[model samples]
Target: MTQHPMPDGRRPANQGPRAAARNRAALVAAARAIYAEHGLDAPLSAIARRAGVGQGVLYRHFPDRAAVATAVLEENVRQIEQAAAAPDADLASVLGVLTWHLTESAAFIGFLHADGEYRRSGALARGLALAERVKGALRGHLPAGHRLATADDLMLAVSMVSGAASGLTRAERERRVLAAWRLLGVEVGPLRPFDG
Candidate 1:
């Protein structure tokens, strides 16, 4: 079978999968940066420009803004999952990591909350699923007889932290995050450092 020319007029190094993955990663990174800088309403063209890829590549990787948002949320959830899985991570460490993530992700989360269309997107569903996993991990770390009643409760706590801390200084945001954790009956130990 003859291979088709790639979108940018370059021949595939090893078929399309590798290039597609790289393009998708670049698109996601661009989307994250653009959204963080300009909120969810930022134009898709901006993401394409930032990724150094054409609009075709961006559309191929993410069909719409919600899809882009979903990719970012999925990545955030993956990082939180990794933190939860760390051998030495305890409840406090987990919360600390989550706090950092939620704070950093406040803008994206706000956009998700505000965009009605995103509420019904598959990405949102996946995000909620990953969030449940996070809640399960937190439950595993809770003291015996202490448990969050539902994943919704965990999400609410996250929302509270993000909403309450928006535009605040890092120290203030950390303070709000710790306070939110305390309200959830989680022990707020030393805040953990996060690379993101």
Candidate 2:
């Protein structure tokens, strides 16, 4: 197999799969933060720089910026799903769980909007699937027959919460999210004023 050239004009060390995977994870995390701060338009070269690795390292891990975005989205989805799996919850409890996930998933939220050339929906579907799981969780908590009825509503609320997170300031974002939860009858924690 032909070895790819490193960005620094050197060859990569003969690292095995485990090391490569670790580096890829680091690069994905760095890319997520950069993308969140700078939006999708952030430069791949900058992502490489922030990762403390070379451009070639990023390219090796993510063939392009979209790939990095997708990986970030997938991570977000994984996290939300894991949170939704917290056992024993009512409708309010379920919404609170989702609220926490959305708060933590701010960076990956961008993937939910990538319907263009970036095409990161595969990664997004994982997160969307979590919403579906949350719907299921909510069903068990609600009164009989009310659980499934809220599926569409919950999904819509998740979408709105995600949208609110993007345009509003961090403080405004939290307020919007809290309001959304309260509207759904979820006993959300009090939100701090916007500091950022």
State which candidate has the highest TM-score: 1
- Among all windows of 10 consecutive residues in model 2, the one with the lowest summed lDDT is 187-196
Whole-model Cα lDDT of every candidate shown, in order:
0.69, 0.61
Instruction: Flag clash pairs in model 1.
Output: none
lDDT of 1 by residue, 1-84 (tens): 123678999865664787788888888778877876676888999988898888988888788878888887777666667777
lDDT, model 2? 0.61
Superposed on all Cα atoms, the candidates' RMSDs to the truth, in angstroms, are: 5.2, 6.6
Point out where model 2 deviates above 4 Å: 1-15, 87-115, 120-151, 167-169, 188-196
* Stretches of candidate 1 exceeding 4 Å from the true structure: 1-15, 120-124, 145-156, 168-196
